[model samples]
Target: MSELYDDFKSIVLNKTPLIDVRAPVEFKKGAFLNSVNLPIMNDEERHEVGICYKNRGNAKAIELGHSLVSGYIKEQRIQAWSDFIDANPDALLYCFRGGQRSKISQEWLAERGKEIVRLKGGYKAFRSYLLRELEESTLHFKPIILGGRTGSGKTIELKKMSNAIDLEGLANHRGSSFGQKITPQTSQINFENNLTYELIQKLHDGFEHLVLEDEGRHIGNVFMPESFISLMAEAPLVILETPIEHRIEITLNEYVIEAQKMYECAGFENVLEAWQESIQSAMNRIKRRLGNQKHSEVCNIFEDAVQEQKKNGSYDKYRDWVEYLLREYYDPMYDYQIQKRSEKIVFRGNASEVHEYIKSVTLFSGRLK
Candidate 1:
């Protein structure tokens, strides 16, 4: 027999590796940082059980679940659990609630001479807690938003600030049409969990100022908390400026070499082919904004650039389209948006100058390294 624990603080703060007994589909929807799913019932069986519970009642659901997952299937599940416990002795197990599924796993584990602890309120309770924690954290964060035109390397400057939170990085996105990562993005709940965790940690460390890059309400599919957005709107801003040539170099590195490294690391096959497909997809997403003729021209040039790379390893062919997109599309869009935000600007300079200004400012000074 294992103890049923309901200590949310310990469960969260310790971050013990979890043997999540939830069905694969449930796990995929949302999960914590250190979970290895070892479900007693697979997705289909879980679905059937859920339907039974809804229509036939809890007792009937239990009977149906037992019938569905018995004999060889039951033994296989217990064996898998045993294998994981053998490898991770400190691991805890939980399902939606510390109910039948988790309890049964515990009984089976005990039969195999292994002890397991279960979360009393399971994932639901903790997830509820996490949401509350996130909302409450907004009060403590004194956001200092980093505002700049595209390719000004706000992410670069953000890293230099000691109290910064990279929400884009947390979302595993670059926060733009072209910000796709080779690695799959985290589920919405998972993204929120990690983001909240980072914020709480910073607050606990006693950093009052939170620096963030200026972003829209949404980054890819991950939306910023409404509270955070309200905070950002009122935060002091530092706008970065760089020469056109410098912007071109920065954007080129991001879209090409740096992006390629991440793509390859994520196990993308035929990396060049992947890059071409991704580039085309990104361009298509912004087609309405780019307008028909300009969109067509950009796509044509992108295709030519891809062909050039495939031919003699010449990605220099991208320079024309990149420059055109910057001058005509991104620069104009940024200028229009920035014009509306004139009152928010507290400082404007290149990265080094901005860095110096941040160092000199009392609000951003003492904590920075």
Candidate 2:
């Protein structure tokens, strides 16, 4: 069992197949990386058991749980377990707390002379291990921060670099309110697992330099790990600069098409409502600062610019407006947080130039490092 325990940890680190015996809702909320849920109790059954535990007692809850799983359901669950064992002979299995449920399931399998290893402390244990690793792991690679203004093609450059860790891309966000993503973001736990996997991959590949886009502590709804952020703040930076027209073109490619598609899917009125709602607080701040007429004019200009961008396929008119909002709202806030962080600025005139510079530096240093 001790040897098997070590083997289980190795398999988890390697992201091998495993069975999670928690309820589906718990599994969906969060679980070990690459684990599949083979629930001991279905949603309603679990809820009923919980209610029984609260209303009655532990013994009554157990009795009700047994009553809920009749002959056919019990048979079905056993068959599922049998099928899983047949499919993965050495698979790791775990439940919520390494308690009666997991023990019962293991005993059931053992009666048939099948050997199944249970996680020592189950999901709770694994969660603790993961949290500790995230907090303490000595990440090897130095981040090459991709710094730029809102529309300056930093994300695209990171994508083009191919040796980059795109935090925003993985988070399915553009890193701002206006930076809504094309795809829905993953749960925060899932994002952390994904980020950890990417980081491990980079370290294992023996890469010494990793390019990454500069982002705030929170990208959309997901907050980055503090350890990684501290590392990023201390690493070298390359500040990209592109002409407003080029930046707008890049922004159009990255966001406009998707934004338009989302608007179309959501309908104009729905999108307008959402956009206005998202910007309302910021608009109020602007109103307080600039007064009613000026605030109204700026809002009108912003809406008109967006309409023009949609109609003309050019976001040039909104460039200054976007810059204004970023400088006034986003930059100052981010600066307040990371003002004294060490950085190196590398400016490029256009996307092509940015891409070229990154590729050249990465390729040249690849051999040396």
Candidate 3:
């Protein structure tokens, strides 16, 4: 009998490679950050086998699975697994419940003179362990939320701190409709699991405090776990204050100039055109909030910027709408919200002062190096 491995901590800590032998559909729902889906059966085969199991029982289902996966199909899968094992020798293989699929995968690998360990309770057990850790990990750190208006450099300053977790980075979003990127955002499970890994690593490195952005429950479509969001809600907030002009510049660069560059880099046929459509869609999302009049003004300004960019390749024209939306739409909303949480404001300052204050607090507490 082969060893049944279940040291999930060591796996996560070591960044262990994982071979998920569950079908693609299962892997798509959720799996470890480090795990690759090299399934024993494809979705169709799994579906057929599932029906067989439901009707004919485990023995017949197992036989059907073998029959379906045999011949060149079996050879091809075994070779893929072998190649992965060669590259990631420390990798562990697993199925949904560490059951027949993983056992069969292991047996095949062994037949080819290759030995690989499979997880004891598999994906289900590992996922449960991670969720438990995610909830419990909140208790191990002191959280500080960095809050600011639309373009007040909250993410900019947050990244400077050694102890900060870039929630936006993890979610691949900037917490706005315009924040959607060229790449797809992570699935909710992937987001939580990635966060759990980050938290565990930080704790391992002896950091006792975590700094995060002042975001609502959802960032784009991904959201924080209830326990995690509860902690963030109660945590003290430090606001990063920047001059209005500077904030406009940051917003212009991030949403307009940088966004265009990203589209160009991704080889869009018409970079500005694609970016313009995206911005228009974002504006439409907040049409009700901006009201018809302000929304029309902002849209006109954006159209002017697009035309100006097309004419001279200058992004300076973007500032008008960017500033308009920041001052008119986002600023007042932020002000109202911040006023309600005035009691939680611990330190408010310019970026430099805010960074220094956090550094000092972290150092003084001796919780983080």
Candidate 4:
């Protein structure tokens, strides 16, 4: 008999390699960062098995499954499992609910002299544990929000802190219209799972405070849990106050220069054309808010900037539209929102000063208490 392991905490903390034997479609719906999809049944096979199970009962379903997976197909799957076990000796196997699928995979591996353990209650059990831990984690740490205008380097500064959680980094977004990265944002389940894992690890590492960049409930398409969002709302705010010119430069580098490099590396045949189109699209998303006249003006400036960059390889012209959008669009919106939370403001300074201020404040002391 194969062993069934239920030590999900240890598995998560150590990032134990996992063979997910569910169907590929099931894996795509939600999965752990450490787990790889090595399905016992493909989508079509799983669908067939599911329909059989519903109509013909478990015994008949099992018989059909064995018939469908027998012979060379079974041998190929066993070989793949053996290869993975050979590379990751400590790896575990799992299915959706720690039932027949994982049991069969474990038994097959055992037949081939590879004794791998299966997760006791599988992915469902592990995911429940993680989400519970995430909810409870809020009690263990005080939150300090880093807030400022768009492009105020909140993400950059958050990365520099030992106790910070880079929510934007986890979401794979910068939290704005122009914030899309070269890679698509993570699925909502993935984002939440990764965030929960980070919280667990950070708390385990003895961090009593968590610093997060100020953001609404949503980061791109993924929203933070409401409990976590409520905690952040009441947390102390530390504003990093960079000058307008410096803010524009940071925005330009991230959105234009560095972004261009990313598109090029991702093998866009016409990098400039692709990137410019994305920028135009992003600006258009805010067209209603920017109002028609301002949108047209900013778009014209952007077009000129694109033309100049093409001709001279200079990004200086790009700054004009960036500054215009910042002054006219983002700043007013940011200021309006920040005003509502003025009572929560605790510290305000340039990057170095804010860093010093954060260092001096003890967790669960002063404003946090």
TM-score of each model, in listed order: 0.89, 0.71, 0.95, 0.94
Best by TM-score: 3
Q: After superposition, how far is residue 126 of candidate 4 from its true place, in Å?
A: 0.7
Give the whole-model CA lDDT for all candidates, comma-separated.
0.83, 0.69, 0.90, 0.90
* Local accuracy of candidate 2 as per-residue lDDT tens digits, 1-369: 541253333654577667787789988887766777888789889999999999999999989877887678877886788788898787777888777677777877777677788887777776666676666544666677777766777776676665688888778788865666535676788777667666666655666677888886889889988898888767766767766566556555454455656766866766644554555555765566556775676677678776776688666666656555555655566555444553345543456766666666667555223
Instruction: Please list the residue runs of candidate 4 whose C-alpha ends up more than 4 Å from where it truly belongs after superposition.
Output: 363-369
TM-score computed on alpha carbons, candidate 3: 0.95
**Per-residue lDDT of 1-369 in model 4, one digit per residue for the tens?**
449898887887898899999998888878897888988888998899999999999999999999989899889888988898899999999998999999999988888889999998988998998889888999988898999999889988888887788999999998998989989888888888899988887787777777898999899998989988999999999999999999999999999999999999999999999999999999999999999999999999999999999999999999998899899999999999999999999999999999888878754443321
> 275-322, model 3: which lDDT tens digit per residue?
888989999999999899999999999899888988998888889988
List the RMSD of every prediction in angstroms: 2.7, 5.1, 1.7, 2.6
Candidate with the larger lDDT of 2 and 4: 4
Stretches > 4 Å off in candidate 2: 1-14, 17-19, 32-38, 51-60, 71-92, 98-120, 181-185, 253-255, 263-295, 305-369
Candidate 1 vs 3: which has more lDDT: 3
Mind giving the per-residue lDDT tens digits that candidate 1 earns over 1-369?
Answer: 438876665555666778899999999999777788999999999999999999999999999999998999999999998888888887888899768889888888888888989888788877887788889988876677788878888998788777788888888889878888877787789888877777766776677777788988988888888888888888888999988887878888899778877778778878888877888899999899999999999989888888888899876987777787788789889889888888989999989988777667635523555
lDDT of 3: 0.90
Q: Is candidate 1 or candidate 4 better by lDDT?
A: 4
